[model samples]
Target: MKKIFENTQIAFALKSNNQLQLSYFLFKVMNSKLLVQLGTKILLLTLKLHLPVQNIIRKTIFSQFCGGVNEEDCLKVVDTLFTKEVSSVLDYAVEGKINEEEFDIAFVKTLKIIEFAKERQAIPFAVFKPTSFGRISLYEKITAKKILRDAEQEEWNRVVNRFDLVCQAAHQKDVPVLIDAEESWMQTAVDSLVLEMMRKYNTEKVIVYNTLQMYRYDRMEYLKKINQEAKQGAFYIGIKLVRGAYMEKENERAEENNYPSPICASKSETDENYNTALQYITENLEFFSLFAGTHNEISTYYLMELMQKKNIVANDFRIWFGQLYGMSDTISFNLAANGYNVAKYIPFGPVKEVIPYLIRRAQENTAVAGQTSRELEMIKKERSRRKQE
Candidate 1:
């Protein structure tokens, strides 16, 4: 409400002059739609051809967006952020693995993160994408209510076990785990599985968080339904509310297949839906814990205002503000400086395996109107502020 996010000094407090310049340069590049499109294509091609591009990537965009190559590599970032009263959610950024071995690797990696979170106050949450533990086609099949073959059922059972193991570790460690949302076609099955985890591990408190992509038009109804279920079952619900990440793919697939798009009609409608969900969660804090995840300043302020109106303390345990690491330092750091709970999602993995996630980050900056420019403006302001000092 007081325009707190404008404090560029606090926003860039942890960044060195070099880091600020690097961020500026990166955002300047990201601001060009044509460049981002061409860059992503070239990077993907380079990776596929097994070209020697890792060093170049490691020095540039990878350093800008990712934490490190593994969990231990992320500790420096986790500690540095906590120096500003901001916490870290260690997110394993590897994607597109379809084999049993890879799934097991993700499962084991997640469990390890939970253990790490258990020992560190700086790390608050552990996260995993649902498809990281299983195949997308399998999830799509189950979402469509198609019967699974015996072998597929066995594979699905392993997927469920992976989820349970992570949730159970989180419960034991007193660490909350966030499950990310994927494409619409596969999300129904994921939703059902996450709800089951909530019922199982969230009896005493919110140890599991399901991501709600508020850009989907029908998520309001889903939220209401879950509210009723939580009340009936006497279990708490934890949700990380995001606007969503897969807009172009969602619309294109819907049109190609002759179904209405699940996405909201426009950005304003999506914003309205996100804010509405935020209001609903804030009003029902007794039954819900929220991690407000966004890069949008207005939405961040709206949540702050809601908390003020409700007389909720700034350090309320049931509420948090989050943004991806290497982005939105304005919101994350300034909120932390103001004594609000904040966490940055620190993604780490091998550079090659993590390219897909990095590509999405670049594409997101390109697709979201004005996001890159705003970031560039903030970095420039900080640089100018520092020079005068």
Candidate 2:
């Protein structure tokens, strides 16, 4: 069972000797919590001071994590993955914008990406964030049941229009689009909008996909209700399932608000919830399609085992495995090699703008027990095997 993820040669085939060394160095640095915290501050400060550190950042961590700063820049990365039978989920990684102009810009960029995906066999899905298309305040107010002023209503309309534009393009181009999940507070509005898009575009098939974060204690029940709604509406539901990325922030918010936390009681609880949701989806396979986004070896193998037990083919269109770029190469490449439908979440944006994303990645690696250690161990094993050759 472990051998599926043990083929480091295929995993590292995309990296050169020097690139491998740099990745090893980066992961080693990320393994230290103190260094990652200190280095993150310094990196942001230097960037704010207009220091010319982008080159160094680009060559090291950025090169490993991001596809590039723009769509054209990602061509080579997509091509390389296609050679190994892996598809790319092109993600516009820009974050932290509050203006309408920026939202419109990201919306246009997403449309262009959908159009780009229409022609590229290597690119299978396009992903964007709801916050990227509108103001957080608008979503928050809507979630909180606050009455919107006329001006605020206009702004919310614009956001809804932007979402429609992107989803419409995806539907027209026959490309699926993933709407990323966010904090639980604002997720109600996001869910409403994504379902509206699903009602519009998912009638024929699953063109609009919603991300489900299984770390939330209520999501398994939520999935059941969503599935029932989809069935009642006679529309297919597309889901990208993950264990969630904002556990600490979510718990902190719940504590600050003096409310019970929505997070699962333990990691084991989250894992069980995720597997249960997957089984539920499998049971109703005719009404749903799933993309399992995880780096956990046990979960990946469990999905494979589920598919096998259910007599599903290795390359079933209804099931997919995903990991982020620059990490979990072993899982991604090996899955693709074994004829599983697989893709990596390839993030791209300006180096400076993507710093937040990179910092979170580094912090996650450090905080998630044994994540960096496991990566380092695999990289060292690969390098050793190469040397022995």
In order, what lDDT does every prediction score?
A: 0.95, 0.92
lDDT of 2 by residue, 187-220 (tens): 8899899999999999988999999999999998
Model 1 stretches with alpha carbons more than 4 Å out: none
The candidate scoring highest on lDDT is: 1
Q: What TM-score goes with each of the models? A: 0.99, 0.98
298: Cα error in model 1, Å: 0.6
Which 10 successive residues of model 2 have the least lDDT summed? 1-10
Q: Write the per-residue lDDT of candidate 1 for residues 1-389, one digit (tens) a residue.
A: 79999899999998899889989989998999999999989998998899999999988898888899999998998899899999999999999999999999999999999999999999989999999999999999999999999999999999999999999999998999999999999999999999999999999999999999999999999999999999999999999999999999999999999999999999999999999999999999999999999999999999999999999999999999999999989999999999999999989999999999999999999999989999999999999998898
RMSD (Å) per prediction = 0.8, 1.0
Off by over 4 Å in 2: none
C-alpha lDDT of residue 205 in model 1: 96
